[model samples]
Target: MSELYDDFKSIVLNKTPLIDVRAPVEFKKGAFLNSVNLPIMNDEERHEVGICYKNRGNAKAIELGHSLVSGYIKEQRIQAWSDFIDANPDALLYCFRGGQRSKISQEWLAERGKEIVRLKGGYKAFRSYLLRELEESTLHFKPIILGGRTGSGKTIELKKMSNAIDLEGLANHRGSSFGQKITPQTSQINFENNLTYELIQKLHDGFEHLVLEDEGRHIGNVFMPESFISLMAEAPLVILETPIEHRIEITLNEYVIEAQKMYECAGFENVLEAWQESIQSAMNRIKRRLGNQKHSEVCNIFEDAVQEQKKNGSYDKYRDWVEYLLREYYDPMYDYQIQKRSEKIVFRGNASEVHEYIKSVTLFSGRLK
Candidate 1:
């Protein structure tokens, strides 16, 4: 009998390699941050097996699973697993509940003279542990929300500090309509996996305070973990300030110029047109909030900016629309939200000043030293 690993910290804190034996579809729905999917069954086989399990019984499902993965096909799968364990001497294998699939993989590997650890409760156990950890982090982490108007360099500042968790970075979003990157976002499960993994590591590292940008509940289509968001609302805030001209420059550089760069290398041409559509689409998300007249006006201003870029190939033309949206749309909404927060505003300063202040105040100070 092989040892089962139901211990949570033992698994997460260790660097031992893990082989995820869930189906590709299961892995795609959500997976650990460092895990690589080497599914025991692909989607179709898993689906048929699932139906058998539901309509018939465990014996029928097991028999059907065996039938689908026999002879050369079985050999191929085992060969892949053997190659992986060969490369990773200390690797562990896991299925959804650390059940039959992982055990079967172990038995086959043993036949091939390979012995590997089996994660006792598998992916489900690990996932439950992470959720518990995230909920606990709300209690452990002394969160400080870094508030700012658009283009305030909030994310940049967070990147410079060890204490901050860049939620926007994790979500691959900037928490705004124009914040979408050309790269596709992860599934919600993947997002939470990444976040919870980083979060618990930070908590374990003894960082007294965790800084994060002020984001609405959602980043793109993915939502922040509810517990973390609740903590953020009640926690203290430090707002960053930059001159309007500076903010406008940063916003255009990120949303327009850098966005153009992203889509260009994205292996897709007509990126300029894509950039325009992004701006228009982003504006559409706020149509109701911005009111009918303002929405139309903002879209028109945006169109005029793109036309200017077409004639002259200069992106500086976007400054007008960016400035308009910030002043007219985003700023008002931000103010309204801030007013509703129960936590006190702790400090307010520009990027340089706030970064310095954060360094001085945070427990992670001198960490780089």
Candidate 2:
């Protein structure tokens, strides 16, 4: 069992197949990386058991749980377990707390002379291990921060670099309110697992330099790990600069098409409502600062610019407006947080130039490092 325990940890680190015996809702909320849920109790059954535990007692809850799983359901669950064992002979299995449920399931399998290893402390244990690793792991690679203004093609450059860790891309966000993503973001736990996997991959590949886009502590709804952020703040930076027209073109490619598609899917009125709602607080701040007429004019200009961008396929008119909002709202806030962080600025005139510079530096240093 001790040897098997070590083997289980190795398999988890390697992201091998495993069975999670928690309820589906718990599994969906969060679980070990690459684990599949083979629930001991279905949603309603679990809820009923919980209610029984609260209303009655532990013994009554157990009795009700047994009553809920009749002959056919019990048979079905056993068959599922049998099928899983047949499919993965050495698979790791775990439940919520390494308690009666997991023990019962293991005993059931053992009666048939099948050997199944249970996680020592189950999901709770694994969660603790993961949290500790995230907090303490000595990440090897130095981040090459991709710094730029809102529309300056930093994300695209990171994508083009191919040796980059795109935090925003993985988070399915553009890193701002206006930076809504094309795809829905993953749960925060899932994002952390994904980020950890990417980081491990980079370290294992023996890469010494990793390019990454500069982002705030929170990208959309997901907050980055503090350890990684501290590392990023201390690493070298390359500040990209592109002409407003080029930046707008890049922004159009990255966001406009998707934004338009989302608007179309959501309908104009729905999108307008959402956009206005998202910007309302910021608009109020602007109103307080600039007064009613000026605030109204700026809002009108912003809406008109967006309409023009949609109609003309050019976001040039909104460039200054976007810059204004970023400088006034986003930059100052981010600066307040990371003002004294060490950085190196590398400016490029256009996307092509940015891409070229990154590729050249990465390729040249690849051999040396």
Candidate 3:
């Protein structure tokens, strides 16, 4: 008999390699960062098995499954499992609910002299544990929000802190219209799972405070849990106050220069054309808010900037539209929102000063208490 392991905490903390034997479609719906999809049944096979199970009962379903997976197909799957076990000796196997699928995979591996353990209650059990831990984690740490205008380097500064959680980094977004990265944002389940894992690890590492960049409930398409969002709302705010010119430069580098490099590396045949189109699209998303006249003006400036960059390889012209959008669009919106939370403001300074201020404040002391 194969062993069934239920030590999900240890598995998560150590990032134990996992063979997910569910169907590929099931894996795509939600999965752990450490787990790889090595399905016992493909989508079509799983669908067939599911329909059989519903109509013909478990015994008949099992018989059909064995018939469908027998012979060379079974041998190929066993070989793949053996290869993975050979590379990751400590790896575990799992299915959706720690039932027949994982049991069969474990038994097959055992037949081939590879004794791998299966997760006791599988992915469902592990995911429940993680989400519970995430909810409870809020009690263990005080939150300090880093807030400022768009492009105020909140993400950059958050990365520099030992106790910070880079929510934007986890979401794979910068939290704005122009914030899309070269890679698509993570699925909502993935984002939440990764965030929960980070919280667990950070708390385990003895961090009593968590610093997060100020953001609404949503980061791109993924929203933070409401409990976590409520905690952040009441947390102390530390504003990093960079000058307008410096803010524009940071925005330009991230959105234009560095972004261009990313598109090029991702093998866009016409990098400039692709990137410019994305920028135009992003600006258009805010067209209603920017109002028609301002949108047209900013778009014209952007077009000129694109033309100049093409001709001279200079990004200086790009700054004009960036500054215009910042002054006219983002700043007013940011200021309006920040005003509502003025009572929560605790510290305000340039990057170095804010860093010093954060260092001096003890967790669960002063404003946090």
Which has the greatest lDDT?
A: 3
lDDT of 3 by residue, 1-369 (tens): 449898887887898899999998888878897888988888998899999999999999999999989899889888988898899999999998999999999988888889999998988998998889888999988898999999889988888887788999999998998989989888888888899988887787777777898999899998989988999999999999999999999999999999999999999999999999999999999999999999999999999999999999999999998899899999999999999999999999999999888878754443321
lDDT of 1 at 63: 95
- 154-195 in candidate 2: lDDT tens per residue? 776676665688888778788865666535676788777667
The CA lDDT of each predicted structure is 0.83, 0.69, 0.90
All candidates' TM-scores? 0.91, 0.71, 0.94
Residues 268-360, candidate 1: write the lDDT tens digits. 679888777787777888898899999988888888888888999877768898899889988898888877773568888988889777777
Question: Which residue pairs of candidate 2 clash?
Answer: 239-346
Tell how far residue 137 is off in model 1, in angstroms. 2.1
The numbered model that scores best in TM-score is 3
At residue 280, what lDDT does model 1 achieve? 79
Which of 2 and 3 is the better model by lDDT? 3
C-alpha lDDT of residue 354 in model 3:
91
The Cα error of candidate 1 at residue 166, in Å, is 1.1
